[model samples]
Every structure is written in C-alpha cells, then in structure tokens.
Target: MAYLKERHLFPGGNTSKGFYSFYKYILSQEDGNRILCMKGSPGSGKSYFMKKIGAHFAAKGYTIEYHHCSSDNNSLDAVVIKELKLAILDGTAPHMVDPIHPGAVDEVLNMGEALDMDALFLNKKEIMEVQKKISKTFERAYRYFAAAKDIHDDWSSLNAESISTDKISTVTESLKEEIFHTQKSGYGADRHLFATAFTPNGIVTFAEDLVFGFENKFILNGGPGFGKTEIFKKIGSTAQRKGYFVEYMHDPLIPERIEHLLIPELSTCVLTTNEISQTSFTGKVYNIEDFCKADVIAANKEEVAYCSKIFYDLIEKGLSLITDAHTIHDELETFYISAMNFDVANDIFDKVVKKFEKFE
Candidate 1:
C-alpha cells in the first residue's frame, strides 16, 4: 500500500510528512504491526490519520482499536501501546481496555491540548527536510519474511518430511537479532526487572535473586499456586516506580488470570507458558543452549552451569524436576518424624541435600 504523505493525506499542503513516512515504514513490517506517535498542531490531523490507519487495517481483515492516549492522564509506553494494539487485534473484552497510567495522564491531557498539533503543517521545503531526517533515522533494521496471503498458506509451504534443526536455529537467531536492534533504540541506561507475584515461599526470594543477578535476561518459572505470580507483580510495580521500562510476555496458550492484574499498567508481570522448543526454567524441555540462557538464581557462573546441566538431565529423563525437589523435601520432613523410616529416608535424603546445599 502507498504511504499517505501529509500533503497527499490531507486537503491543501500544510503539515509536514515526518510521522507519516515513519508510520508507513512500520506498516511495511512483516508482522503488519505499527505504532505511530502523532505530534502536530491542533488541526494537523492527528485524530484524522489515526482513524484512517485504524480503518485501513480493519478493512484488510486486521483487528483495529483506537486509544485516546490522553484519557485518564497516563503515560504512553511501548508496553501499553503494544497491548492496546493486541487487544484490538484479538477482540478482547471492553473492560480489558486500559486507561493511561496515573503518572502520565495529567501531562498527556495537558500537553496534548497546548500543542497546536496543527502547527506541523509545513511548506514543501519543510516537508523535504523532515523526510530527509526520517530516511536517515530509520534504517532497514528489520529483515522481512516472505508474506503469505493466509496462515494456512504459510504453514503449507513449511510442510516437509522433517523440519531441519539448523533452519529453526537460523530463524530464531535472526529474530533475536531483530529484537535486540529494536530494543536498543528504546531502552535507556537504566535496566528494568519484572517478576511474577511473590509467594511467601522461597519463590519470591528466588525471583529477586534472579532479577538482581542477571544484567538483561529475565527469569520465568511457573509455580503450583498464585504465590509466585504475586511476587512478580510487586517486583514489576517496583521497577516501574523506579523508572524502568517493562514488558510482560503473556503465555499464549493459557487463560489469563493473575497475569492480567498487571496488564493495565503495561508492566512485564504477565507471563505465558514457555515453548518446549525454547530454553525455559519451567518444565518445558530445552536444549543445553536454551538452559544456558536462564537466570537460575545462582551465585556464580559455575552454579549456573551446574543448574543448567541438572535441568537438562531432568528434562531428558522426563522427570518433574521441580516437583521432585518438593517431593524430596516433604519426604525428608516425613522421615524425620517416623522413627522407623528415618534410617532409609535419611540415607536417600543425604545425597540430594548435599547437591543443593552447596547453593546456600
């Protein structure tokens, strides 16, 4: 689709085409995702273009939703913007619609009105200068995938006797590189951390160590109850309060629950189940390389490597590693109570205790 330059999109040449080209560039992405930040004079057509693009996507069988960034005086961040986009695309409940963050709402509502927005209208010379800046700033940082008319068509092309591990690795690496580049543009000197809720159990403690231990990595592990998620929320909220940008990666396959609690804020407290193909601290089976990426709440690199190897062994053996640890702990407690079984239980527990005790 042709990009709607300011002069072309509006009647009479007044506003510059700076944001328009940027919007067009976003639309050109393989995922059909775009987050346009409109800044112009009062009558410069911010709302007009917003409506136009939203309608265009809807007509193309894409989901569309409009958000008033100034409503409720919230700060607009990438997390909120992306969630809004996803909510529109997914047709989520109306209650799921989020207000601007309390911290940002006042500023947005006030600044939004004071700016002419229409003041961006410019002559051809100004438009040219703006376009030049846009071209220079936005390099082709993304690699485009072959577009498919439909999802089925895309899957059909991938039908093979067997999927090659090498191809999957290549695609994963390329996607990670793309994400790294995109984040580099938005991230600041201050690093942010996010976690699930803190259960009174050691889950909360584990999460804190993981976050404080890793520089840029995230640690995600599902627990049997809501405790873990609760701690994650507090950590996420704390990070946001400390001026850190956070983005939650929601589990796609599970129904939304406590994870939704942090949604309106756009903090990274939401979590989705890990992919079996990816390395995750959760039960999902992962390769050694995937395990290496985990922030295992360990003190040193040696512990990290050991825990990863242990996780791989457990996954390969089809053992529930987490459950096994808990079960063994319970057994240890029970053995201590039963005078008769103490002999056997003590022997079995001694070896396992020795393994994890070093971490303490």
Candidate 2:
C-alpha cells in the first residue's frame, strides 16, 4: 500500500535565540486520541522505535507526519499518524513534554526500564563529564549565532526602508484569489513546525517533500527583511478565518517568523527562498526584490556585502561549535548504547506497534 509522508521540526534549535519550541502543539484527548511520550537517554533507539511503529501503520495506508530533530535531521523527534490521531514524541530535556492527560490520553514508554543497571552505574562519571562539555559547547555556539543575528538585523534595516508597502497587496492579490475562491466562514486551526533546521552537520531541510504534489504554489525569492514572512502571515490568518487549516513552517533561525505556509484543503502552498530552505520551488516565483527600489539596494551594496560576510562567518563558527559538541555527544551515547539491551527494546517496539494495529 502507498501512503502520504510529511516531515517537520517541532523545537528548532539555533544560535539566534537558543531554542524555540512548538511542543505544546501536541494536543491530546481534546485534540488527538493518544500521545506516547518516550523517555530515554540519547542513542537509546527512541527514534528508531518510533519509525518502526510509523512504518507498520503507514504500510496499511495511514498518513504519517515525521517530525525531525533540529540538531540531527536523520533522527526523528516525533511520529504522528493523522488518521489515528495518535503521536509518539521524544520526552527528553531541552524540549521536554509531560502528559497533560496521563493514562487517559497520554502514556509513558520508558526505554530506561530495560537498561542494564550495572553497566550504566560503572560509566556514570564519564556520562557526567560528556554532558558538561555538550552544555558548554552549545553555549559557545549560541554566542556566535547571537552576534550573527545582530549583524543580519542591521543589514536588513537598510533594505526594509526601500520596500513599497502598497505593492505588497498587489503582489499577493492573485494568491489571495487562488486560496479563497471557494471559502467557508468560521473558525479554523493552525499548527506550527519547521521545514528546515540549522543542524550540526549543516542546514537540513525537507521543503521539497513537504510541498510536493501541491496543485498551486506561490513562492517568494529575495534577501532578508523584504516582507516575505509577513506575506505568509497575512495569507495564513486570512485562510484560518475562512475555516481552513494551515500548517506554518517557521524559520529555523528565527522561529517566531514563518517562512512557508501549506493549506492542505486547497492543495496550495506559499513560501520564500531563504538561506535555510534549499527547496527550488515551481509555480509563480515572485521575486521579493521587485518590491524594493533597485537603485537604493545598489547604493547600499558595499555595506550589505560587509554585513553579509560577517553574518555568515559567525553562522559558520556556530555550526562548527555545534558539530564539535555533537562529536562529544556521540561519545556520551556510546555509554548508554552499551548499557541497553537491543532485544528487549525491539520487543517493546513490537508491543507499541501492536497497540496501534487494532486502531480502526
């Protein structure tokens, strides 16, 4: 059986503002049917376990949303089966989530329960030392990121002044018409996630896959501070007010700002090209720079170049620090991996899948 697959990031971690999370979006009984919070140390097979369960249901034609980790794109932070209204998430620190309706709507799946106590006990000191390094390394990376954001903001202020506010609506008029041609009035909902992340390895994005097969697309391409995200917000809010569900994929570096919008009901999407999103969009490609006076940007090119160099350099420094930190984290994981029994974990994985097999 063939099924639909989607990917996103919940808590996007970066240097600009440290870590920004959308974990509260994990709705339980009132929102969804069930939520499974997996408790375990790093490299304890939580991601793999979740994948196994997702695969089982997807094979039966269920639509699955795989939430990838910001720091590690290869790893998953959560697995959501929309058809079942069920989700499984990594319940660890940084973005820790506890059950709002334990037992009733939420359940804890603890992998540590099957750990070899003697093995972990013998390696406790090593784990402590590695943990210290990871924390400190992240701190250093954040500093670099903060500096880069400050510089980036300064550079963007120059371009922001030249934008034609009135033309914004004109540019988006076609998109507005396309999205609301057959609209219903009432209240709708919105969910926030990330389509890209500033990972230790580098910028990892799933933009192409997320927007794949959509009938219509409105894409923006230009430099920062050109009102790209604001365009997304305007269309997104209007869509919501019209009783349409919208999935907002935010900027990983600036999590508060959205970079893309997906309205599944309409089979339409809107987005902007950015440093983080490596997606090459097809459809109406609107150049955001068109709204800005070319002469003004040309005059400020030197300063823009200066700021751009430093901003990206600082970003590179941050990524380097994060990479180093993860290298140390890998060492820390070795201890946990050595102490865990794969056979027991696999058994637990099977039981978790079995519970969902009976779901309507």
Candidate 3:
C-alpha cells in the first residue's frame, strides 16, 4: 500500500491532489474498492468528478447507484425509520437505501403538493418564514413514528379524525416504554453473549491489543452500551495500521464509497448492523442492486469457511467460540485470519474455541 504514496490514480481527474491520493489508496486494497466522499462548493466540480468516476467505473463493468439529497425528499433519518416500519409491517426487510425507506413515493410526491399548499395559500416570503417551522415540525415527526407502532392496537376505536394529538402522544409513549421494560420473552435468555474491552485512552489511535492473525468468521453480539461501537472503531484503526485501505460506512444510505471503489469492476466490503439487512431488498434497501450482487461478494469468506468447519461440532458438543470481541465479529475476524499464516491460524482457532467454552 505504501507503494501508492508517490503515484497518482488520476490525470486530469479532478482539481485536487486528495482525489489522486484517494484513487491510489483505494486501488491498493485487495479488491481495489473504496468509498470516496466528494464534498466541495457547488460549482467546484463535485458533481463532475462524481460523474466522471461513475462512468469510469461503469466502463469497467462495475455497478453504480447514485442518490442526490435535496429539499423535496424525506431526510435520511426519516427514510430509515419509514422503511423500518414498512419492513415490520410487511414482514420483509428492505435495504437501508430504498425509496420506500424515505416514506412512500407518495410522500415525496406529496411534498410538491404540501409545498404548493404552503405557497399558493401563502406568499413566497411566508414559505421562507415557515422553513424553520417545517424543520421544527420534523423534529416532532419522529415522535409520530414512535407512536405509530400501537396506533391501531384498539382497531375498533380507530378514526383518523377522531383521535386527538394528545392521544397520539399517549400511544407513542406506551410503545417507547417497551424498549426499556424487560420481559421474559425467552429472547433475553437465549441472547448471544459477546465481550468487549477497550483502553481508556481509546483504540482510535490503534494502540489496542492486536491478534497476530485470525482463524474464523464470527459475529459480535451485545446489547446497547456494552461497547460494541468502540470495538468497530478499533478494527478500522487496526486495519489501517496494517497498510490496508479502509472505508467506513455510518450512513443509512448506500455508502458513496461503493460507487468509487467498484467502478470499472471494483470489489469492496460494506460494514454495518444486521438491521441493515431489513431495508436492503436484493439485499440492499435503496435500489443499489449493484453493490449487493457485484462479483467478489462482500464478507469474510475464509473465516466463514473455518467457522462452518467447527459449527456442527460446537452445536453437538454445546461449545462456543471464545475470543476477544474483535476476533469474532464476522467482518474483522475473517480479515485478521486471512492475514495470518497456517500455523498461526491453527493456534488462534484452538485458543478462541477453548476460551469460548469458559466465557460464561
């Protein structure tokens, strides 16, 4: 990867050396995949560069999906919540980046109507005046989402116009209460156990403990506040230290990195929560089918194979995988193992499983 430091990935590609560095670094990865963010003033070639890169990737037979945020559509959060609701309602998870995630297309279509209602009945100045009002209204819209889960619990009593705003608030509060109120649903007892540890100074600096290599694929499971997020950040920092390119996706939308990394047949990895699985149809929420299906599938294949090897034994013997949180998260675990030699793989595998038996 250091070999890329002096080379440029683009000529006349853009107006900045950052773009050149980005191109080369992304190319240095095993799959030469990356997520690149192009942010600049409106006329500073952001769009032009995106188009150029998109086309370049397309010419190489890599898939591309693009979405531009603007005033008319639902905001990113609204999209995530809306699609999450739809998935639960329909019992089919949608990709995080779906149009449905942004509330029905009707909502987007209705925006024109809503804006017209604001405009035709009011002056241009009035519309501008309500801009803040609209923003404030959305802040409360998330409340409606919280309440919506049980809006029809008493279906026979339902009437859209008959229900008062206060009633909505009451119902929303009831639903919100369930998140913290534990119940013996068998889920709590059967829940997966995961462990995580971090130094107070933080692993963001990449100074946390390092496993020389990894040996299997694993899932990192823990409830909120148990330090799962910190573990993820540490993995990113560590991978970067190993001289491998890294891309982080914290967004609900299809990551922009995929566009840049896989263009012209780029291979890339996407990391996020399992909740992401709910929104992506064709395994993606937004219509970014290309990212989900592109050749060189995203996942830890070696660890997956290794895990599959011992899975049945563990199930029959009632054993578990014992290792640090980072060694088990399916994504990082595979990469760590892949970077190791054969002897290291065997030792780590045995150590991880032996410790897993004593994790309780």
Best by TM-score: 2
Model 1, CA-based lDDT: 0.26
Q: Count the backbone clashes (under 3 Å) in each candidate.
A: 35, 0, 30
Candidate 2 residue lDDT tens string, 123-217: 88988999999999988988898898888788878778778888877777767886688777787788887777778778777777788788888
Where does model 3 exceed 4 Å of error?
A: 1-123, 141-218, 251-360
lDDT per residue for candidate 3 within 221-305, as digits (tens), equals: 2111222234344443433443334433221111111111100001222222221122111211111212122232223334334
Q: Against the correct fold, how does model 2 do in TM-score?
A: 0.95
**Candidate 1 or 2, higher lDDT?**
2
Q: Candidate 1's residue-wise lDDT over 40-108, tens digit each? A: 222223343344444444454443323322111111111112222321111111112222232222111
Query: With candidate 2 superimposed using the best TM-score fit, by how many Å does residue 352's alpha carbon deviate from the native?
Result: 1.3
Q: Give all candidates' CA lDDT scores.
A: 0.26, 0.80, 0.23
C-alpha-based local distance difference test score of model 2: 0.80
Q: Comparing 2 and 3 by TM-score, which wins?
A: 2
Q: Give the residue spans of candidate 2 off by over 4 A.
A: 1-3, 6-11, 26-29
| Candidates 1 and 3 compared by TM-score, better number | 3
Model with the higher lDDT, candidate 2 or 3: 2
